[model samples]
Target chain A: MSRADTAGSGERMKVVVTRNLGPDVMPLLQERKELDLVVWPEDRPCEREWFLQNVPGATGVIVMLSDKVNQELYEAAGPTLKIVSTMSVGYEHIDLQGAAQRNIRVGYTPDVLTDAVADISIMLALMAGRNVRETTELVARGDWPNTAWAPYGFVGPQLSANWVHPTRTAGFLGFGRISKATLARLVPFGFTDCVYTSNPSSTPNPAADAETARTYGLRSVRRVGLPELAAQSDVVFVLAPGGAATHHVVDAAFLRGMKSTAVLVNTARGTLVDSDALATALRERWIWGAGVDVVEGEPHVGREHPLVREPRCVVLPHIASATIETRLGMATTAAKNLLGALFGEAMPAEVQM
Target chain B: MSRADTAGSGERMKVVVTRNLGPDVMPLLQERKELDLVVWPEDRPCEREWFLQNVPGATGVIVMLSDKVNQELYEAAGPTLKIVSTMSVGYEHIDLQGAAQRNIRVGYTPDVLTDAVADISIMLALMAGRNVRETTELVARGDWPNTAWAPYGFVGPQLSANWVHPTRTAGFLGFGRISKATLARLVPFGFTDCVYTSNPSSTPNPAADAETARTYGLRSVRRVGLPELAAQSDVVFVLAPGGAATHHVVDAAFLRGMKSTAVLVNTARGTLVDSDALATALRERWIWGAGVDVVEGEPHVGREHPLVREPRCVVLPHIASATIETRLGMATTAAKNLLGALFGEAMPAEVQM
Candidate 1:
């Protein structure tokens, strides 16, 4: 399609926001005089049929991580769709190839949430390592009436001291922007070595990895296989992108390879870890503990989730980027990206072809 | 009492533990067979009469910060007390001069809690800065149904970004072990300058302060007055000791001097801050927010506390040294101190007379 045809065919650019982004982001579109906005009123997921019907006339759509922007949606939306901006740092929900074929300019809020997510990752690690939830629950439930001092009654590893241990090692699965930031935060806690396995790019560079490690004051950063990462690490952080290519990467073999004193932290995606395997690992004490920000089929997660029921597992409701400051900054950044793209200006974080 | 008289006068070496300690600590005395240990059964404050009664026979007493080991208690003990081992790092509760005159050896647990307290200090700071309490409450109460998207809703400051503005600075009320550790953690988050005030010690030297700052990779660390610390700091952290010398140091004047965008974090002692003044500061928005682990008269703290009701103030139960691993290590260390002092062995951490 030519530029003139695409511009003339537009029947008011319709944008659908799958879930309520609150006023912090909504006003950015409402204030725009040129665009027409349609919002999902309910907090629940938008129906597939409703989304498909709504997308036919839309030139751009602002979606959440929960919304799946796939080939069918791209075909249904047809040639009118020019951009798909997700209000998240990760863009795994959108099919990259489909978007590429359709020439859809993808914009995601990255780096804006690096600090917030990194902070939460550390919080979860501490909470899990310290048994904050269990202890707090004990105090809140008034169970202290029968409590007495006992050896090893309630104890979790202290990350700082543990990091300094001679045997301690850290592992990152698919180390990228956020993992690097997380490593930076964990460095002072005495993490001496790091090994990561990410999806191989066309060309591998040793200098890039070395520079990244130096930036975080890491002693060493080496690329390794999954088995080595699991076997050697005291704390193995699952930070890989979520998709079919990396789904359920942390299986029984991987968990079994981890030391009995090891901890696992997953801030990347729920699908990256096999829920059943992780639950078993925690229940059976294959690893000391696990801190999970995302669980398989989240938002539907409730009391019955294996992680939720396990005392050793600290489960958070996908709050890695839920900080108010980060969320607002992200919303504004996404808005700027959308507005910039629409006006033929440079997008702050545009998906490269 | 001379050494000969003291050695022969003991019926049984009576030891009073002012609060509950680990079971392992009690067993050390039980195993000796020559010691009579009087343990506090409840978490409540030990009555003055009860403490006095126990002190009369106490050759050694294990006390917490809540107990005041003053001259009166010493006089009541009648020269029987030979040692005072405090479970905490601070010694403000003990009357140093009174103990010194009687040649009482004082032992305290320090350096052991540096990592634990530092971890909690960062936790509280992040929790307060990110509105963790409110957000968690929102999820717990199932308030997502009524929530709306706002351009800037529920946003807190990110520590990773440039937090220092011309009008914003980071201040420390006491530049000690925990504060130094906290400073090291904040270095990755872009804190360039730090100002602190410390009580004058016998040997006045700024060398320790300079060395600490340099070790943490901070650009500058300088001693300033209380008013200057309050006026210049964007985030004022209270790690100062609590006593008449530094009681309610962060009063109305200090809060008033703080920038509107500033935050206050108190993990040291509740008495260092004026509760009423802090409530007013938060209610009136004198500063952005506050994260308080210690409140005035804790354990007695309920939902009715002024800071608890305030949205901006994040009130946590005193869990600064509450990490599972740290607490366990502390329990074991405290036990070692008791056993070591009794058997005349070298204690891993001992307070000098």
Candidate 2:
């Protein structure tokens, strides 16, 4: 999509923001004299009908992941809509083909969230492998006095290398930017090896893998099949993108292949793992434990949630990137993408179509 | 204690263990042809009366931290008692002066458990800083759907460095082996500065501080006063040894001076931190949050415990060194110490009186 002709014509255009992005990012949209901004005033999700009515004449729209950017929404905005910027990396809800046909450029916030997400990934790994949920609950439920420490009372697998375990291995279901960042955190824990599985059709890149090993001072960093990854990893991290091909990739067979002492952590999309299968694995002790920030059908998870019922399973709401600094970065980048697209400037992180 | 005359002469000296050390380590005692092993058969803490009865005429005794080794124990064991080996680093429960007067050597495990304890220090820091307790409880209570992600729903302070936070600082209350190991884990998180407080009576060593900084690739690693430590640190770690001199070192005034964004983690002895002061700090928001493995009075920390009731405060049972490998190492070390003293070999770790 080329620069819009409506930009800098002294013409006033309407801009709809799905929600107020707090003090740090709202000014980016409100300060524009050439654009009249209409923002949803509530702290909850913006209503669809109300959004459709306010977005009719909008030249650009800034939206959260919950706000769908579909064909019907595009038609409601008419040909005046030049772009849709989302405050998330995933754009599965957005109709890319329909937007491209209408010359609508899409912008997303991605790399800005890598470090925040990676930090939580490591946190979950520790919590899962170290019996944190069970241990903390023992204290909170007033059962600590009765459940006094025996020599092996609450013992779990150690995450870091010890005299008994001089070499540690970290595995990734998908080796992307966040995965690499998580692996970097493990180097100091004396992790000597790394195994990962990426898109199978893509050619292997040993040169890149060797360079990564050298950078982290690791003994080896090699790509492998899922079975090998499951068998070799002390901790398996599911960080692949969510979609049709990747759905339930960590299924019963994959879980069955894992070491009984291994830990599973998922910070990626919930659909990438089979929730019931994971629950069964934890129940049967096929795997040591799990820690998940994203669970299938989240926000609907309740007390009966199988993972929640498992004491060793540390289940958290989807908050992998909910840090103050990272959230501001995401919101600011999202706002800039919309402003830049409408003002004939380059979008900071545009999806190439 | 010198080489026992009873050993290897088939004199059949009695050896008493306060509690069973499990199959892996039980063989060390059971296989000694010159010894008669009498182990307390229960998983619970050995009864004091049973221990006193079984200890008479024993050449060596192995005990847990919970077992008290005092004048009564020495009198019960008579002049034949040569050593007491404890499967713990701290020996305050054992009367050192009394044991020295009785000419009994003391052995305790220390450095073998360092990595396990240090690993949990980082886990607690992440849990404290990242709102793990509140967020997990929200999901567990089925309040997630109503409290679904708004722009800033569950935001927290990030632990790792980013463009906005280019440098991260890690603070330690005591500069010791465990503190240094914890600092090594922080290097990959992009921590650039480290501030620590050690014994003030000792002279400062700039050359040693510089060497530490270089080793971790940090910009600075220097000893600071407690006030400066509270003011400058992003996360304060209490890793100092706990005793009368350091009791309640993290009092109200020190907590008030800390950054509102800083997190405090206590993996060392709980006596160093005042429970009521920490609860008030959380209530008043003087500091962000805290994660603690020990409490001022443990095994007595019920639901009403001040720190346990705080949403941001993550309290765990004292399981920092409760890992399969670490516990095994401690048990083996304790057993070896007793065997070495009885058989005239060097004890792996012996306390000097």
TM-score of each: 0.81, 0.98
- In every candidate, how many clashes are there? 15, 0
C-alpha positional error of residue A282 in candidate 1 after TM-score superposition, expressed in Å: 4.2
TM-score of 2: 0.98
Interface RMSD of each: 4.9, 1.1
Per-residue lDDT, model 1, residue B197, is 88
List each candidate's DockQ score. Answer: 0.25, 0.77
Evaluate candidate 2 and give its CAPRI docking class based on DockQ. medium
Candidate 1's residue-wise lDDT over B1-353, tens digit each? 23323345535678887766665456665676656788877666567788988788577887776689999999988777878887777788899988889987777777777887887777667666666656555544444335443434566666555312322246899988888888887776667788988886635457876776688777678888888898877688899878788889899999999877678999888899998899999889888789887777765665666777777777656666765556555655666676566556667677666
Compared with the true structure, what per-residue lDDT tens digits does model 1 show for residues A252-343?
A: 99999988878899998889899889999988989888888777777566666677777777776667776556777777777777766665
Q: For model 2, state the Cα shift of residue B222 in Å.
A: 0.7
